[model samples]
Target: MKLFADYHTHTIYSHGTGTIMDNVNAAKKKGLKEIAITDHGLRHFTYGVKREKLKRMREEIDEINENNKDFKVLLGLECNIISSDGQIDLDDEAMKYMDIVLLGYHMMVRLKGVPSYVHIYGRHYLSKISKSMAEETRQSNTDIMINAIKKYKVNIITHPGARISMDTGRLAEAAAKTGTALEINSKSNIMTVDYLKVAAGHGAKFVINSDAHKPEDVGNFRNAIKLAEMAGLTSHQIINAVKS
Candidate 1:
């Protein structure tokens, strides 16, 4: 299997070390056909892209697309799941500027309300300490993620089992139904081989991404590719890959 695109990449708009152009250049250098400039959403406390800058980022990407006929750059946001009810940090206004949407569970997001805080964050941490809460939290997390997939036009779920614990089979079932690909992130080891196998068994599609924070790291899918291979995933099951 060979990947043709790197859908989950970061830029200076968020916590990344490179500009959008820098990442684009890096992807090109790595011989990738396409890349997405997926910065953090507006709610990430430390690294979220400023809402006002969305327009500017859109313009930048447009110009790049105009100049390069052989390559594609998609403007997307690595949006946060802000509430237990599956409300993400993205809105219709933000959606206008996006070519794709990538949602994931991340810590330190400005959530919907206190209720969301208690349900999404409080319980998550509490589960770490209490064995009884672990199963409940895992179920709740899976339910919340499935809700989000049903609620939004999410193209991908970045690193499903990364920041929190979730039932991979359950989440994958919902993702397959909704046509949302689960990410195999190269930057983190959260998506284990076991998780990949479980998710794939539910007929869910996948994407291998660098999750690159630096320009030079763009299109670096080695780790993710190895894990996917270990899980016996073929190109047909991966959105960005092709049979070689």
Candidate 2:
């Protein structure tokens, strides 16, 4: 069997309704080579990973790593894009301990209302559509995301098209330039086929993620694979965390 891995997941520290041990146990049962615990960054209005929780999560991951030598566990953050200007919620100090930092825009955090671009295109459109000011946010996100990769050398960016939007072409361009991978998140609404095709067309690398909140959800990569094949992604184009 191909080595399976899921790089976007949450634990109880995230208020994710599951324990860290539950996630690890799930990974073991699913036969995954690795699972990344990427709980929401500190900006989540109601439930976010605070410094203390992150420390504890790391300690837990360390213990899991020692015990479960058969599997690799990654510590990560699904940092919220706090504003349209694209600034991530975590400060420099908070990001130091993380293995990966994935950025996303949340409705509760990023937008006050549907931006004009989304409104004009229809609210359901998954591609990034933002006002000029929102571009600052998008650009800020782009810059911040790119800079995080440069600064911390984080491996991947989480779902690019959640509540926030960006120009896929530009994002692909950035991903290519930065050597970072963009995610096809299965747990969120599937990445639009058009966006996937456009991204692959640009030679951007990709990551398939479940964004799993529960242990049972860990290795569910079905929708992600469908989008990948639809986009004509080959194994070489995917950046699986467990693989080289």
Candidate 3:
């Protein structure tokens, strides 16, 4: 398979095992034209990259670009979605330094104090919450997703699955209107065939990502390709950063 770009990647700067050079080398080995360093944004309690760390990573990328002419590294941030209440941890100034901004729904940090449990299993597996709380969480996630697209003009929404709650169809419409690609992450098996069918029906463009937290995972686009095939995606329906 021809791998053009792997935009969702993590480095040691984001509390991962991979380094900036490790990722770039892996991508070159995989014959990719470009790759992005999209580590978790600041405010993630467990493993997020701070602004200073991001700057350092950017410098490393610049150095690599100056020395190597084979691949391009785009600096990016996987900004965590704070809540369905329209809260985000990253600001515009922070966004200005990034080439791409990706929004993901994870429970590492919840501003509403709804407990970190909401993130581990997402709204789908919560058996202990009251109906009201569940509904609130769901609404909050939907609102956050919509607002993230409107607020940042984000390049893509990363992995809106696994532990997140939102109407896929509605979110797809918002993505289409905002020009934000909805990512099909290979890290988790959350973007089910049915979900892809729904999103594709709404004319949402899909971007494939490795979501590689380690060097070994970089450029492994197998699962994403299978899911896209299951979704009946045509070549024109998928977005390739190099081709774009």
Candidate 3, 100-177: lDDT as tens digits: 888887766645456433542455455236676666666656666888789776888888755666767788888988
Q: Flag the better candidate by lDDT, 2 or 3.
A: 3
Compute the lDDT for candidate 2. Answer: 0.71
Model 1 reaches what TM-score against the true structure? 0.98
Kindly report which residue pairs in candidate 2 clash with one another. Answer: 84-137, 85-137, 86-137, 86-141, 128-165, 128-166
Q: After superposition, how far is residue 70 of candidate 2 from its true place, in Å?
A: 1.7
Off-target runs (Cα >4 Å) in candidate 3 are 110-128, 131-136, 241-244
lDDT of each: 0.93, 0.71, 0.78
Query: Which run of 10 residues does model 1 get worst, by summed lDDT?
Result: 159-168
TM-score, structure 2 vs. true: 0.80
Q: Which ten residues in a row have the lowest lDDT in candidate 3?
A: 115-124
In candidate 1, how many Å is residue 29 off?
0.5
* Model 1 residue pairs with clashes: none
Q: What order do you get sorting by TM-score, best first?
A: 1, 3, 2
Q: Give per-model CA RMSD.
A: 0.9, 5.1, 3.2
Candidate 2 lDDT, 69-96, residue by residue in tens = 7888888888764433345666777776
| Tens digits of lDDT, candidate 1, 1-244 | 6888999999889999999999999999999999999999899999999999999999999999999999999999999998889999999999999999999989989999899999989999999999999999999999999999999999999988878888888999999999999999998888778888888888999999999999999999999999999999999999999765
Which has the greatest lDDT? 1
Candidates' TM-scores? 0.98, 0.80, 0.87
